[model samples]
Target: MEEVSTKPSGYKEYVAGLLAGVATVIVGHPFDTVKVKLQKHSTEVEGIKYRNGLHCTVRILATERVRRLYKGATSSFIGVAFESSLVFGIYSHTKNGPQPQVIIPSAAFGGAIISFVLCPSELVKHACNKAELLQCRMQVQGADLIVTGMFPGGSTALLRESVGNAVFFSLNTDSSDPHNLTDVGIGILTGGLGGVAFWSAVLPLDVAKTVIQTAPDKSCQRNPFQIYRRTGVRGCYAGLGPTIVRAFPANAAAIVTWKLAMKLLGIKNE
Candidate 1:
């Protein structure tokens, strides 16, 4: 069996997280696309864009090509690469550093850094996912669009990241503790559960972010509470089922891949 390293450098953590980001994007992007579509669909419409996750996925596959499901994948790749690198890098650094008790705070700080990468990427990705933009080959305002689009969701993203990261790192740390259990199985289980906890905690914020990001009209970009008022509780959680489903295997794979990559790079958990 491979031994966990007690001391992993920042570079190794970044690289491992980069690999994990790739794995996570490959597994989770399609589901995310569906989630966004569901979130952005108008609740006041006569016929819903999608009834649920399964229906949404099927409709997309049937009407659009398989590639449509991966519309924003490139942007997502870029975002996740930087975001995960910083997150895991900071997380490992703080966890292995002199003051290790501040794991939650370390993760929260990383989450804040993540917004800078995620904001622009999400803008491009969401724009690319739009039918009008796709038909126009994404001929839209460049920097101006990104700037305007990201502004509305900045606070929501911060809250989502801070809370979500705290949940993920804390749960993962408990699960991977040496005294608790043996083998990678624990990591997988804990990682999956961590994903669930993170997403569940941040789903409302995510709903608001999706609304602001994908809104066709600037007027539709409302505050989170405004969105809650308009859409109500059920609408805010429109895609919760699919998100949780995607969270499990996607995060499990990401965590396992990160550990394996770190092992290959000669970094082990202490």
Candidate 2:
């Protein structure tokens, strides 16, 4: 069989990506909140905040209510929506162009764009997640809990996105040929694997970001190296379980939605 063009018009891909992003945030925000909490938990603290993902989910629900799990939802929704749009839009544009072997490069470029948005958005999301906890622990009433700093971990984010998208788009491209299964099924499987790869590659950086973002004060200036030294290898992967669990369904849905939206818009593989 001849190679099929997975290209879609830029506008179509952007719109599809936005839909995918919304679906991803709605499905994955709670798991993501828990993952951040788990990653940022310090052994130095008097007591552990959560024993595991299950424990974390239970506690957040019981004490903070379901809404707490969605702290910073608006920021994440907006950020991921744009981020996904950029990723898909760029990928579609580049793949359709005359450039040879463009998939990897397109993915890498898309990743770079994603990093810019993810840094600030992630910072806000993490701060929002811990705002109540911080307020309760610090006993500061009506305090402005926004954390601000120069963006760190852009390189790692780039690596994660480039590598993960490479895998995702490559797999997605290969799987687009419909033998018996629907496009959605192929998208789901490939997307889930891509999500797993993305998280696995970036979990360490994520842990570092969590630590820095959730630091008790501006004086708590610890880099990724410091965090590694303090927590060791295991610390870098504190919430791997929840992240992987969250990755499959959320990303699968996002990818499926993206592909389906493209189909609905009459963008066909040729």
Candidate 3:
């Protein structure tokens, strides 16, 4: 029987994920800020508030100064860095193996593993960005007192991407080459689908997360789940459309970047 060697240590993967996160934030924070703001303050004027990503960017830069545009960048630096570290590290290693099914579980596990660091940072950043996030909205949510709000937000991301990837790949094609254009396209499609699926499945959790993360210091009488349920289903997934749009391309970009980095470092897998 062939020997099955042990997978790489979690510590190494964690470091990779963190590094990727940091790199992503540095390159993408400005766009991220604009994306968040548009999602948060969506309006129904003549039907819609903002036209598209470009329009939103133009408006924000014209009005909200480039500096203020990235208000929660510091929090993002921490949150995303940790989140990506485990995500990419585990994903790259596990998916490269024979037993591909491990990818889903590993991805989910990676998300959970890194939540200890990600959740807190995300809570702080999202809370801090609440005002800017909902600038045009009338009754904006607050972003304070969110220590306990970590579970749902943190866990859902894990559940979404990890499980989503697993399910997606299972139903999709079986490609051996990650660098092929078709393979990359499939990855993008799978990522976007996964994002939508995750968002849909955990919209309620996200809504509560948004509330808690945004309003960290509020003394609300309602339970987190209770408030989410009351918002109706659609309300929970308020940003679902944009999120899906972002995920497909954004994650693909990250994957491409990581792969390029690996090649540069002379790393290869059979």
Instruction: List the global CA lDDT of all models.
Output: 0.77, 0.72, 0.56
Report the C-alpha lDDT of model 1 over 1-270, residue by residue, as the tens digit: 775566756488899899889889998899888887877773635565677878888988998978888987996788777788888887877674433367788888888878766766666666666767433333454455544645557788888898899888877764243223365788788889999999988888899998887766556656899888988989888777878999998898788778777777777653
lDDT of 2 at 41: 76
How would you encode candidate 3's per-residue C-alpha lDDT over 217-244 as one tens digit per residue?
3364235567656787677777776665
- The sequence of per-residue lDDT tens digits that candidate 2 reaches over residues 120-177 is 6666556666786455424542334333353545555566567667766655664253
lDDT of 1: 0.77
**Where is model 2 more than 4 Å wrong at Cα?**
1-8, 33-72, 97-100, 129-148, 175-183, 212-230
Per-candidate alpha-carbon RMSD to the true structure: 5.5, 6.5, 6.8
Query: What's the lDDT for candidate 3?
Result: 0.56
**Cα error of candidate 3 at position 60, Å:** 4.9
Using lDDT, rank the candidates from best to worst: 1, 2, 3
Spell out the clash pairs found in candidate 1. 4-268, 4-269, 5-268, 5-269
